[model samples]
Target: METGIRSLRRRWAAPLAALAAWTAAALPVAAIAAQNTITIVVASSPGTGPDILARTVSQQWAAKSGTAAVVDNRPGASGNIGADHVARSRPDGSTLLMAATTFATNAAVNRTLPYDPVKDFAPIALLGTGTLALAVPPSFPAETLKQFVARAKAAPGTINYGSPGNGTPQHLAMELFKQEAHIDLFHVPFKSAGGAVNDLAGGHVSAMIVPLHTIQPLVQGGKLRVLAVMSAERAPSMPQVPTFREEGYDQVQVDVWYGLLAPAGTPDAVVRKLNAEANEALKNKDVVASLAKVGIEPAGGTPARMADTLALELKRWPPVVRAANITAD
Candidate 1:
């Protein structure tokens, strides 16, 4: 009986020890995966351009990486709130910012930001760029870019242009247009893009410079007309609409770009991994199609390219903001 019991104990001991070893090995991996779960923070409301772009890419990235990811919209202070949040988060590569052109523009216009736009975040990938279009109500007399410019020149301050608000890209773009065209137009600021678009469609406003996709429905429905796109070249989504350069306003180019960024001090390996995943996501056919629907052209590239873009925007907008006397209010 003693010999039988000893044999049974020996037999059980090896299997039990193996099971314990396996469980111990698996625990750290589970913990690492939990730590790797990413949170993409967008500094805008849920349906905005950055939010959509973040969701689209993150969905593909998570599927490819087999990791969980989510977008957290912390909209306020013209994107500063969400940006600052990511800046303050742990530099563990788990929290990222889905930054837009406003990231630089905010720094250009505001003197007291909570985080340094250049130093607080590290550029990861430039996801894409969306074109801005100059749209007018159907009743506006301008039929072509030349005609629009001529009318604005003739009327000067009598013609008004609406924007999402003061210090916005729309406001600055129109101000740049005014400078390039040598025309003066009254500036009408709205609390929101929807408000400005609704006013433009209702003919309460004379014209507006907004994302092409945002006003496409109204343009298709004959409520608004696009005179020119504010891109270096005509947008593929609306090739019929000429570019500002085509209209002979070569200096009036403003393409809104979006990128991904991580907190400063995040490991270089983590940033490289995120960039590669983002570039792969951008190459996905479904992702490309989805972005195209909203006038965003895929612009995947190395982190250096994103850094160059941010640097250029930072240099470009400060003078414009100062000249136009733009304010965040």
Candidate 2:
């Protein structure tokens, strides 16, 4: 009887010990995931579209997951400073980076970036997408895209067009338009899009390729006239404005995008977790309403899709930068 009892105990003990080990390992992982405070670093200034989106999403992300999420702005070197900080952070999902089209643009223009654009970060999700508008001052004679092109062809590099600044997405989009249309309109780089809009309203500049959100009010108020939009399709906010494709400018598509990323070594589970949270926030009624007010269309998708966007843009913009010789500094 004693020998039989010992044999049964030894047989059961191994399985019990295995279960115990698993529990011990899993409990700490659960605790760490729950305890870590997520810091979402926005590589842009306060009140910008990306900053606003980060705050809005984090508000709900924290509420849903019971995890603390915060936004920190580190705006400089055209957002490279903040992004680099996150790149070098531990890949524990506690540190994240929110960036816009400038992220890829900076990568395309600068070869000496501190972080590898592809290898140093893992994409979480694509936050949103927006477009730039081709607007002329109210008094400018060109009322349509056709007329605008005609005027440009008549005098290459004679008319001055404005953008937020050299090497900005707006500038690059216009450069792409110029290349596609075979027109050489002179560039008038402004310190800010608002300044360019002001000059356009005042008839100081002939035309501008500005963001629809920023210039929408002026277009509605009759301060500026939008001849066309540089999007794949007509923007919902400005359906009245035809797309460049409608006028046979196929290569003029320039859609500005925003995305989230974590350090390269961040676990795949964490990336999926963040992506799921972002997609959920995008579907929330409140999030949709707020983003609409900013004239931004929410875009949430797989990390792979976001990665593909970055890869495509990196391929698309380098040639344009070289051709335009654009330098922000």
Q: Which candidate is the best by lDDT?
A: 1
Model 2 earns a TM-score of 0.89
Q: For residue 219, what is the lDDT in candidate 1?
A: 87
Cα lDDT for residue 245, candidate 2:
90
Sliding window of 10 residues with minimal summed lDDT for model 1: 27-36
| Whole-model lDDT per candidate | 0.89, 0.86
lDDT of 1 at 216: 86
Write the residue-wise lDDT of candidate 2 on 184-269 in tens digits: 99898888767888998899999888878988788889999999888898998878889999999988888878889999977777
Give the lowest summed-lDDT range of ten residues in model 2.
24-33
Candidate 2: residue 227 Cα off by (Å): 1.0
Displacement of residue 71 (Cα, Å) in model 2 is 1.0
lDDT of 2 at 34: 77
RMSD each, Å? 8.6, 6.6
How many collisions per candidate? 0, 0
Q: Could you give me the TM-score of model 1 versus the true structure?
A: 0.89
